[model samples]
Target: MTAQDPNRVFKSGFVTIAGAPNAGKSTLLNRIVGQKVSIISSKPQTTRTRILGVCHRPGAQVVFYDTPGIFAAGDRFNAKIVGTALSAVAEADLLLAVVDAARPDPAAEELLAEKIAGRRLPVVIALNKVDLIAEKGALLAMIERWSDRRGCQAVVPVSALDGTQVEELVAALIAALPEGPPYFPEEALTDATERFIAAELIREKIFRLTGEEVPYASAVTVEAFKVSADGRKVSIAATIHLERDSQKGIVIGKGGAMLKRIGSEARREIEQMTGASVFLKLFVRVQKNWRKDAKAIERFGY
Candidate 1:
């Protein structure tokens, strides 16, 4: 075997994205990875688990961990989700704190500032959703506010939805990471399995189409996944767990029309993601206050 050249430099490390709910953290992860590694929706707390998105650059490999939004944990489940986000902060080589520039939340900003305080890791504040801010002064003020609050190493304004200044944000993050070999293969985009992604796609549709608390009380689990003989098609059977029977009825809707709509939208997305025909079967069941039950929450992989 030949000896490796000492002059060849590579930067690779984990970058955790943490922010308040609906702050565009997941959107940023998807945009930077050039794929939909994390589910995105307007509803808060849509992401309940840690999602890893790997970005392979010319001289760097960044494994981005998209965490649940940091917020006040009013219940056991909420606390678990917040704990997941905080744990991600502790494992990062660099921290990208995304903040909504258009509608800045002081409490959310303060929560992140406190978590990152006294940490040795480099922190970069991503002032996200800049496209929504029509006033240049407001955007500049937001940048300054976060800079003063977190004392981050860099503040890069970006709009993850429209790919505005996203490359610049990536450059900033890569610059902060230390040089090392790639942590993941170049072909790998995320650590999540196909089953998990399919389930998330279904949940995302529910969050998008449903109103009120039904979306928040819902969870999807892929119970069965099968591939056709030729591998040209995929079949998935998932169960959507609801906290109440009424919610189940809401998800099913009249004549099962709502469930069909959710299934059709999710199937289309899954097909696009897997590059194969997808037959998605969705079933709704009441779990009886599953969110409040620790056992049920663990069973659902929250």
Candidate 2:
């Protein structure tokens, strides 16, 4: 049957977004969800886990999972991040291998082929950040190479930041989706809990404020999330853990200004996400090498 056949039942499936670091995978995912479920930052490997954001339309439910940008495994923490990203690839019913259309890296292409080679899962390539390229021919060449190398079902060029060709990419995802019952409620946008989103939002802000390895070596934990009986407010106590006291100070900023700014930005985003005025209480602590601590890594949801 045709993709738009009225006689066909609604389609549903898990679509995983996978690519190398700074490939715009998270950006594309945020656009697809029409909300910021996955955090994005200028830093590489901003996403550390698989976050499922559901997209329900009139005739389909596309459960999209945004994963950490897949990079070559390095240290303990990075290995876990790569592990989480690869697991999403294996679990997905449809895979969108995202790539940066402006700068096509050969390493990314090699890794994509290595991970997906011989897999039977339906694969589509999304050429993201096409707006960065001045010439359309260059974008076309990149798409052609990826499509030829990967045997993609469709190669959709999109600029996730500018909303260029995003809807077409979503349509491609929907067309590839398989027939199944909706895994989430119609109104449910994400499978993650409020605590998870809050922690991620805080981390995103931290990444924005800090430089160097601060974002990579840091983790946030929500000690308590309590809602007031008034149903209009949420109170949260959270801890931001760093590997060293020096890193802690960096996160806290000079005279507490940086930490205050980070908290304010995170609180605003959390309030929007939770639909409540959030009174976020943030504390910075030294985990004393948490990334290397296996137990601490597990607790951080790595």
Candidate 3:
């Protein structure tokens, strides 16, 4: 976890967060990075890709990868998502293993452990959502449990929601990094483009506003992103892809009210992200059973 030289002036490396669904990995990353590079929701598997965020400090820059949750998969689609979660652990110089202390799932934690077992990377466990646990003894017991886990360099309890012990977690991660110069520029927060973020913001609205299989069966793609000549506003044209024809009416809503709600909420966030007023155009289209087709998943940028 340290460079060969004891007096190295700088340190930089990648830290990938691996854990179960709704473990607060994305929330932790957003808090540490101080921006909304990854969207958050109560739903599992909200993050599908390798979302990269760069944390720039005075002497170090820690790059982070927020991936899909680790879960037991019985189908092709879920297996792909689980693969993305596991792949990130191997590529980083350090790993942050997060778990929900209030709602412990031994099965999911064990699955996460199995994937990272016997790896040489520096591992730090963050028992997240500690604020939800009222009993001090329970927190102590859980802390002891994770401390005994093999291959862990540090065990720090945190609450990503209220900024409790998060700075301590960040300090632990920075201490484990090897000596190197900053990997990204000082002003840079993430590598994601505006178009990709706009699409994700739109998808986040669907996940929060809709229910059942509608969120899982849907994806977003940006067709047009054009800035005006004076650069005061952005005009975006995007489509919400659905796996079944029946889901279209659900997203479109009665008298287009649902779509209007999703669009208005998404546009405001995009405005905050781009610092420009946005004119967003959303459309719904169905490609039958797209999740069942591997080619369709790839085409959707999954």
Candidate 4:
């Protein structure tokens, strides 16, 4: 059964994108879905929960769930984050194991292997960031290495950032999906709401712009989202929750410059998404070690 079948049955199922931290799982999801349903950053642990995006094709609707990166979940907080990713794994019909071809983390890879071992799920390994590989032999070796490690449906080398061989990867995933009705409407792109996506966009900007403990300690919550008549404009009130007063100072910057910058950047993306003018207001507050506290984690939607 190949992806190019002329008379293929309509297929749809959940394909959970799973891998270690910074392996380009979210990047691949966004690329395949053709939208930024999940956030991405250079920082590890940027994704904290499951983000679902639907890919509509000729004969199949591929529902993709982007999971948080797998890590050494020893501490309680880390354990909770890892638990979220594991739960998504339990819901997968096909596992798209995306691995970074540029940088390898053996410990995290071992952890991922252990968690999915004996699950009997059909796995497809995507060697993302292949465009970064100057040596074609190295990419082939990695593909061979992954193929020998597991009985994957396919081991595809791709550059999720550059859309290299992504179509092949998509066809492989959709081909693996079981025959069924679409989980979401053909026009639907993601399961997340506007409020959630807006907040995520804000957080993504923070991750991209900030340095040190700022991104790790920060979480955004949309306090109020009001849309005007006919939905041409939206007014949003969101808070950037931090772990310390010092961190809040860092985000606020001199004369509220940093906060303004984050808000401006986030608002532009929100406008593009909503196709409406976004009036965004961001406030920074200290939650004081919220990442370590369970209640705070829940409050932050992690």
Candidate 5:
């Protein structure tokens, strides 16, 4: 193959990653962007907001929006999350719908297809988690099934966890994008602020360490973020809000051991991301069913 010209046409556009809860949308976004722009956990609905991650290919710049998982809204909080995901559809030049091949949900898939049907943009379905499928026939069946689905331009089987065939998925998405200039600076990694990423890291630890409804009912807010005069260290103070006093106790654990563990792990991640030492202080508070309260939900930045 001959060397491509520097003046070759460059394609740049936004691609939104949407799927059901625990479908590995965030993982796929991180894999494609080569960075951790969105938090990940085994818990469903881990992502509550839209995160933008930029990828600069050889001849294209693909901006990805990692959206919250789309699901049936059962309450005010869930409705807001689902709304956030659905709203991104209008802003995207193309849609990359991620589906968990290991655990398929036809109802959720149908709903997602319906939302993308009228958008008139190309939709690429990624059959993620193919590594988890023990049988090759099962994987093939899933690829066939998604190929027959409506509104899908192409179906690519991939394993987001181990980066199996992710490059192909990226190529497919880039091919769908129209020729344009870069949407963001070439050096930009994400649109999220440092404080927001710190808060999300804490929440991810909560989701991983806590059990039952504790993680779902909890929210993290970074009240203070300070960098030392020398810029060698960062001081962060955050609060963990829950719906009940009992839930707070569960997060605090015996003699505050659990809270300490969460803080320790979160601080490490924050330091790694910022390349500076961190002093993290955590406090637990009860908001008394904040998920149901519209004002509280808004105040928490949901």
Candidate 6:
């Protein structure tokens, strides 16, 4: 007699999580995938494009794409942001219209209603940050409003920080997913490469160090990345290109102390991630008008 296995093959699909700036979209993604694929900050509009975070379960692979927050189509940059978010919704097998449960906005609801007007895909409303709501009545009211407007497949209350209802959310997402082969290896956590993560780490450090225009106009690119085969040590050289010399001075700070602190913090994070000694070398370069330079944008993987 032949032995029969009880476990059946599971399905896979894509889930796109998108919302307005500072809505805790990235925080939820990092929690769901259990890694930092996207950078987080108190600053609004930190994410500029789609960042993929993969989750591997026993019989399924869920590739979650975290897109930039949805704002009104403004300038070229803002248009790019809106386009990326909407594109993810259009292409995804499912979408999670993540809303900040603590601070529900009517504008965000209107945006969601407009998107779901003619779409056939199932959208699971992730009412995130539910822990912040003190009154249960307010939470229910928010849920009822969204359900009435868009008729969500599921309106799940969750705290992405404390991880309440996240597993159930994952299960709901997987159940809605279409059948497919694994999109990525089980061991992979993100679609971003080491170099991209390194640059992001540096950018994140810059975000923490300086405020205002410097963070807005700056971009980091890894000029060189080298690692030993045994994984004992790593060498990375990156350039922080700015639009003007004044921004560069602010980044470097008085006596270069600010830059040094930034480097130390980034290197420490890199070391923890790679479990290797790190030799981080940073340079401040002037790339005037890089954000508007098409060639520079392409080179930076934007």
lDDT (10s digit) by residue, model 1, range 72-138: 8899999999999999999998999999888988877888788888776789999999899888787
TM-score of 1: 0.96
lDDT scores for all predictions?
0.90, 0.87, 0.91, 0.88, 0.91, 0.83
Give RMSD (Å) of candidate 4 vs. truth: 2.2
RMSD of 2: 2.0
- C-alpha lDDT of residue 134 in model 2: 83
Question: Which whole-number lDDT from 0 to 100 does residue 299 have in model 6?
Answer: 73
Error in Å for residue 29 of model 6: 1.0
The TM-score obtained by model 4 is 0.96
lDDT, candidate 3, 195-271, per-residue tens? 99999999999999999999999999999999999888999999999988779999999999999999999999999
Structural similarity to truth (TM-score) of each candidate: 0.96, 0.96, 0.96, 0.96, 0.96, 0.91
Which stretches of candidate 2 lie above 4 Å from their native place? 1-6
**Deviation from native of the Cα of residue 159 in model 3, angstroms:** 0.9
Error of 2 at 60 (Å): 0.9
For residues 1-302, what per-residue lDDT tens digits would candidate 2 score against the true structure?
54366798888999988888889888888888888999999888899989888887777889888888887887988898898988889998989999887888888778877887667788888888888888898876777777776447889999999999988888888888877887888788897899889999999999888999898889999999998898799999999989998898898888999999999999999999889999999999998888888899999888
- The C-alpha stretches of model 3 lying farther than 4 A from their native spots are 1-8
Measured on C-alpha atoms, candidate 4 has an lDDT of: 0.88
Considering TM-score, which of the candidate structures 1 and 6 is the better prediction for this target? 1
Model 3 clash pairs?
none
lDDT of 4 by residue, 51-99 (tens): 9999988878898889988887877777888899988888899999989
**Taking the tens digit of each residue's C-alpha lDDT, what string does model 5 give over 126-200?**
999989988878778778877876666789999999999999999898888898887788789899998899999
lDDT of 3: 0.91
The reply for model 6, stretches above 4 Å from the true place, is 1-9
Model 1, position 148: C-alpha lDDT score: 72
lDDT of 5 at 150: 62
Model 3 per-residue lDDT at 110: 90
Candidate 5 TM-score, true structure as reference = 0.96
